[model samples]
Target chain A: MSLELIKDILLATVPLLVIFPSLFAFTTWMERKALARIQNRIGPNKIGIPCTRIGLFGLGQPAADGIKMIFKEDIVPRGADKLFHLLAPILALIPAMLILCFLPLEFPWGKFMSGQVQAFLLDSAVIFFFAISGLATLAIFMAGWASRNKYSLLGGMRAVAQMVSYEIPLVLSAVVVVMMAGSLNAKEIADVQTGFNWFVLTPWGLAAFIVFFVAALAETNRSPFDLPEAESEIIAGYFTEYSGFKFALFFLGEYIAMFAISGLAVTLFLGAGDGPFLAVAPWLSVVWFIAKIFGLIAVMIWLRGTLPRLRVDQLMAFAWKFLLPLSIFNILLAGMSHHVTVAYPGTTAQVVTWTVSLVGMYVMAKGLDKISRSTAKPREYLYAE
Target chain B: MSILGGGIFKGMAVTLRNFVGSYFSKERFITTNEYSWRPESELPQSIGDYPKEEGEQLSDTTTVNHYSRNFPMLLHDTGEPMDTIRCVACQICERECPPQCIYIEKSTEKKENADGKPQFYPAKFDIDVSVCMSCQICVEVCPFDAIVMNSQFELSTPDRFGGLLVRRDDLLKSNDYYHKIHPQEAATRDERMAADKAAKEAKKKAAAEKAKAAAEAKAAAAEAANESKEDTE
Candidate 1:
């Protein structure tokens, strides 16, 4: 690429770098508040209230927590491999930050120019987004391996296993979208999705959306699938040896990952940055995009609150046994359907694709319902012996 | 394929329903003043309430709003007022208390009972209510059933120690008071007591029969020895 292109790329990155972190922080607050509601408990309602009420139900809880984390004592384990310990959090954080570089916040600012590309959007973004997001697993594995704790090692191993297992389904799910959209660029995907024909309404798009959503949850290491940081089992997993601002970096990375995944979901399924009367008021799409993201985050919080976590084996089985095959099938079907649709416009092949997808979805859903029913055991009350 | 999207929509529809349902299910929503409004007497005693009773139902109405009210409400079981708890100066509660809030002084009563035996009563039974975890361990382990968890959980105080320190007079309750809070369990325990008494009576009858048999055998042996001696003479 020319120097001007390089300059354009750099300029484009600055806004995303700033905006992405802020989005992560926003999600952190939203997750807490939403989960609190789901769990039937009041979240932080204390800190920023007018007067310093002793137990004024801390409204500024997140702010207080953030402040506390900032001033927390940074601890480096005496026995840990010092270099790895130092590198782990940075490794964990960098990839999450970098993934935002390709995430399309909106369609190219106003009619994509030839040389000087806009700041907020990307031209060929989808491939770039997936590739970078896929790299987060590397950062996670490094953090886990570097920690030098047995728990950290196990967590790292699980992180790697989980990431690797889910990555297939995650990518395959996206591949279906790519097949239909016929481009690796996210902006084009978004552009197509604008108006009533949102991808979530399409056959491959719906499947891709579902798989992608589940995969996003797995990738972010959020609840139910958070075997890595399972407080009960591994005790904060990869970050067990980390503390203070270093730990904060890992913390921020997680939230940013959530933000990125939410954004990606918006782009792929919900019609990224597309709003009512977007032809008239294009800026309204940003609100729609954020709303979609927040909605996903709310679901994440709901899952966290309502569901008990999955076992490591259960999580792996979910990825490999269920998600992987389905995603692969979805990808194959999408490609075939797309090819056939292109070869013969309005043919029986398209109808076949539609019918097969419907039947397949019904079967999968029924199977899941059965699995869930059989697997779910009621919690027994313990009368103290 | 449209039907496939139907499943996704169905899922979203359920989520939407949940989103609406959540608004109605504000019962789970956490509030700072969740339990503040309910009176101490109204507050439901959980498992670990000091001075335990069987089958106590703690009220949900006693949110934090009731807790913030600036008054000490005397705890009651139903309508009858229970100003004190049945904690004997046994110090068992004090020693076994996890938080070490209870303090007791065992003293012998100089005044004799109808049997002319000294009565044991606690001179000072003080529970530093501020320190009490309300874990109810004292109620669980109390041998005499002297101490039980009370339903009065509202113990918020401005002075951590002053008003919160429950004196012996503050914690005492009658057996009738316990029964009122948990009548069914009390009745069941009463049934157990009757069964135990009946069992003791049956054991006594069996023991008497064995004693009489042993006495008759001894007498027969003595008679035989006497008769043999007479024949020898």
Candidate 2:
């Protein structure tokens, strides 16, 4: 039992040490370089050791930045709540890191290794992922209330509001995926998505996916939905009081959150790590898994590079009006499909489910548009009474 | 258009074009953002390939026009090992300068020119670029065409007194470097100088010819007087 516990600990620890730093660094480099390219500028091309031309085109930059952050002075405010201000960064960082524990990095190995590769397995990992990610909002709140700055406090409030607003749609969309698979196990969901038969290949799954992706963007505090940490408006948001290693911790948390969220998205919609001929090679699935994660991350960066932040009122409107309703309807469609597939069985069942769900979703979307349009137009006032 | 997230898709397409357009056809980004710290030698002269297509070779600094005048530099003749600071310590630029950023100390030891008149050059020339507004007043006020502004703009430095102070040696640029940056202006200046030189030479030649004619006319008149006297006797 002790040996088993040690082996399990090693499984989690090995990926944590090797993968997290390299992953975070790569994401940082990729985001900057891609953002630069999108905006038509060269970003971070010069940071490296003194002599060589082998700078890897700003790959060394994150390391340079990380080192710089470590050496920076850690300052604490005089009027700050000493305990929580000290704990804020730790609170913010731990949840993002812990989310990685449930994310399955599945690879196929026939006889030599375990068939299903995961750091740890839980039957209710989908529930665990949503539950754990929801806690990151608390961390943001903790940082804000503790910092003693009004801006930091406001940022903490925004984080709470946005997270609460988006979490409904986020969880609702994932519930649809969970309903489709009929199991909460991450690996089992991936197994169903084998051979290009991903849930996203269907209309209902596609809508859920779009909703989930947008909510995930909001949840992770990415741009267009990045009001919680909008640097221009909020002056570093909850992290305003943080500096040096404390600031670096917040950054680390964000990067890890991005990885975890995108990793979960890959598993849920794009067939976890399932690709064609992945069964034959087995170990090749992990490569496919990583590629999908990076691909999703690239999309996130593209969105960040492209879109401007929404107004606070506009942001709230989008969550309540569009995402909330759409996700609920998606749950309805997913449940119906599951019911029909079990009751009737075979291709006719699939065809019936497809037609009903697609048509139902289309009708609901039109109804939503009309409702929004009507509500958007306010009556004019004749007098300034 | 009422399309779902229409603005987002449109903005995304625009960025996608910029991202992809940067690779295939770079003529779109006409003016690259010139970072102050990036070395002039390391700047991208033309839009480089997107990182995926080709390995981004560090590009040359952009070809700036004659008017992009960031800072002023002294033009030096390449013939005599960078001989002559074009500024003669006239101080016309010094007085006319709005910022009064230029400092000129006249050389006490003056050397006589071909005309046997003493010519003065600056002993110590400095332009506090930190203070200079880059208005090109010094270039305008220079009488000898010595302070023509050159387009080497990157003047960012760490030190205030040491780094921001433009020295005489660092300020002097070769005539070729000036022409490369400001070809039309350099050419026009050279033509004007050549025309002035030609007119001066023409005036000198005419004076010399008139002097010879006067001396010959005096000799002829003297001979006539002698002949007439002899005939009368």
Candidate 3:
């Protein structure tokens, strides 16, 4: 049992430690590059190989940045809570790794490698992923509280408010997938999404995907939803007092969390590791999974580069007044379809139900928008004579 | 504006357009130029490529002519064996400088210049660019037309305090440099100087002629007075 535990830990940690850091390094570079392109600027291209003189189009940037971060002076505030201040980043980072244990790196169609490809295939992995992710909220709050700074405290408060508010909708959308699959197992969820139709193609699943994605943005503190650490407003939020490796840790945690959440989104909606010829080459599933995650990340970067941040009130309203009600409706719609699809799997009843819910969603959204529009921020305009 | 998710889709479309257009389109050329790094030999090569011929302005974007304020400089003769500074140690500029950044010391041991006159060259000249307001007041007050503001403002240095204190050698630029930067001004100054020299020469010639004619009249009057004395005897 001890040997088994050791083996499991090694399998889990190898990816988490090795793949994630490299992935994070490159993802950061990608985000910077993509954002630069959107804004019409060169991102990073100076650090060239010494002898060969080939810069490789700024591939050395991440390595240079990593080294610079490592060499930077570590600063801890004089009045900080020494324990939690030190512990916060660690707490924040561990959840992403913990999540990697349940997350399937490879989901071979009808070909099992005794579940060795995945670190763990727990039945309750979906709920567990959500639960583990919740720890990050505490970590952020701790970082803020420990710093004894007003900005940090406010950032912590925002983190708590934003995370708790959006988490409800996030889970509700996840529950839609759960109800449809009739199983809490992640593998089962992904399996159900196979064949010609991915869940995102379905009407109800489309609504749920939108909700899930927006909520995921909030959950992971991606921009447009990144109110907790809004640099202009809160001065780097909870990590204001952190420096050097500690700050780097926070950054790493953020990127890894993005990966973890996007992975889950893929599994639930995009059909994880399910692609053409997956029945023949099961390993190709990993490639499909990675490709989907990267696609989602690219979208995230695009949104960040394009959209302005939401006002605090607007952000709260978006989570509570907008996303919450929409997701609740989505859950009901998903449950009804799940019931129909179970009795008569692949029947027109499912299609009818999907169509009904979609129409209902549209009408309800329009009604809610009408009400909100009346009460929302007024748009004053000038009259031209 | 109040439509359901329409604004977001529009914004996304704009971003997508920028992403694609930045690469392939001339109209949407990325304003970002990676200009930080270059080989040491690149500057002269670039300068060579630029049209240095008269009457044609440079069309290069990298050309540094956007409101380039040449720093105040002292014009100097390049090949002369003697100390060649146009400034005659005049203190008008020293007293008139608003910021009082310019410092000058007249040479106690004056040197004989080309005109065989005792010339008071500045023994030491320095300008604390840190304190300088760059108002061109010193340039205005210079009686000898010695000081001129150069069209080069790239005077940034690593040292925050003392390094910006420009020395005598650093402040000196060739008259050619001044002409290059201010062609019109230099031409006008040259014309005025030439006219003044011509005026002085004409005055000298007139005075010499007048002296010669007066001497001839005096000799004739003395000759007449002597002849009249002889007749009386």
Candidate 4:
């Protein structure tokens, strides 16, 4: 890479680093506000200047929270392994930040010239992004083990188990997209999704997209799957020993993962950088991209508010028994379809087979729903006066 | 099945609708009790000022001027009239009251009144109504059942000190009022009283039989002693 290429990388990477932190902060506010409404209570409404008599929307709450978190005495447990304890949060945060560097914000920087050399840099670039994000599990495990708390240890163990289990499905889902676009690179994948027919329109693409989205939710340690925090039991999980800005880093890491995953979802499943047609501005694609990602983030928040965390056993079972098999099946089917299409060229049998398989999948799913309903025991209630 | 996308489409559609709906209005999306929207007329009397039109409507039901009688006046439920509560000046309720809200003064009358007996009536019975927690412990432990919680929860006051303090007559309500406030509890208590009455009658009958047997045995012993004395003579 030339100096101009390096400068372009910096330009892209630095702005993201700055942009993502603020995005994390705003997402946190959205989650809190949404949760408050769900649980039928006011949340964080006491902060900010009163509009003479009323606080008026509590606009300054996030600022107040940030200040409070900063001032909190940074606590380090006496029994904790001091080096790993200090290292855990940073470990957890870095890979999440690294993910931002690889996320295909746009196709790429077009062209760069350094001194005597001239070259075309990818409007879309490298395939290493997914592999780097996979390393976030190590940080999580390190945080869990280093804390010297049993809850932390259990949480760490669950984190490893969940990440490792779901990672297969997560990767397999990505494989469908990779196979379709014939590129390991995210930007290339986004490039394949331009104009009218985004890759998400394809059968394999749709299946992979849903699987990837669900896997991302689990990957981020978000609610409905946030057994790691298990407030009722674990008391804030792996970050139990962390406080102040160090704690904020873990907080930042979670939100950034949320942003990165949603960005990935939009790119893969939805039209990556496409917006509604308008003659006025082509740049609205960026706005559309941001909106779609934010929309995904809001659903995560909604899930957090509405659903209880799945039991550890239930989560593991779902991953291994259901997601793993389906993901494998999806991968094999996508690979076979691609291979046959290449070999036969114009055979109509491939489309017929695909259609039949889809029909079979729908029937099986409906049957399962029926079985689930029939087997579900009515909730017993005590009507004591 | 292909059209439905294996139920995944259905699932996605539900969540997509939910996602879109969450943005527009959370209240519309949310299914929850609307306690705040309940009309004031339907609402139970609150801690603050009772809504005026409802209060006036309530006031029209009964005309009780016992408040102006000065010596601890209590309102009847109907508000049409005031009935003097038959308090025998037993300060047991006052002493047992947890909040120390209830107060009583008792002085014996030298002259016997209409009941042909002289005891004492509460000269000044006062209960600081605002301080009462409405726990009804005073009502529960009262041997006389003289004090009771009323359905008239509209005990709002402008002044915390003077206006809120309910005097003896103010706190007092009729027996019928207690029956209205806690009908089921009163009915249960009455059932228990009848049972107790039946148990007492059976116990009395058994006692009388035992006494008669003991008397006959004693008489036989006396006759035997007299016979022995006559034989010795």
Give the candidate number with the greatest lDDT. Answer: 3
Per-residue error at B201 for model 4, in Å? 19
**On lDDT, who's better, 2 or 3?**
3
Weakest ten-residue segment in model 1 chain B by summed lDDT:
B66-75
lDDT of 3 by residue, B1-233 (tens): 36688889999999988887766765453354223233455533553543333312211122233233445778765545246667788778888887888899988888765455678888888988888887888877787778877655445555577667887777777777666767778788878877987999999999999999999999999999999999999
DockQ for every prediction shown: 0.15, 0.35, 0.40, 0.05
Q: Could you say which candidate leads in TM-score?
A: 3
Per-chain TM-score of candidate 4, chain B: 0.52
Off by over 4 Å in 3: A1-5, A50-52, A107-115, A339-348, A377-385, B1-3, B26-30, B34-233
In angstroms, the error of model 2 at B17 is: 1.0
The better-scoring model by TM-score among 2 and 4 is 2
Q: Candidate 1: which stretches are off by over 4 Å? A: A1-10, A49-61, A107-127, A339-344, A347-352, A364-385, B1-233
TM-score of each: 0.65, 0.67, 0.68, 0.60
Score residue B31 of candidate 4 by CA lDDT. 39
Q: Write model 2 residue lDDT over A1-385, tens digit each, in one string.
A: 6885566566555766578768898889889988888877766788766578766687789988888999999988778888988887888778788877766675333123433367657999899988888888988898899889988999999999999999989988988888878889887888888888798888788989888999999999998898978898989888999899989888888889988888888888998778878657866777888889899999999999998898798789889998899889888888878888989989999998999988888778768767887887565677322
> In candidate 3, how many Å is residue B63 off?
7.8
- Report RMSD (Å) for each prediction in the order shown: 9.9, 15.6, 16.2, 13.1
Deviating ranges (above 4 Å) for candidate 4: A1-6, A49-56, A107-127, A278-280, A339-354, A363-385, B1-233
TM-score, predicted candidate 4 vs. hidden true structure: 0.60
lDDT of 3 by residue, A70-149 (tens): 99998888899999999999999999777866666763421352346676678998989999999999999999999999
Candidate 3 vs 4: which has more DockQ: 3
Clashing pairs in 2: A108-A282, A267-A272
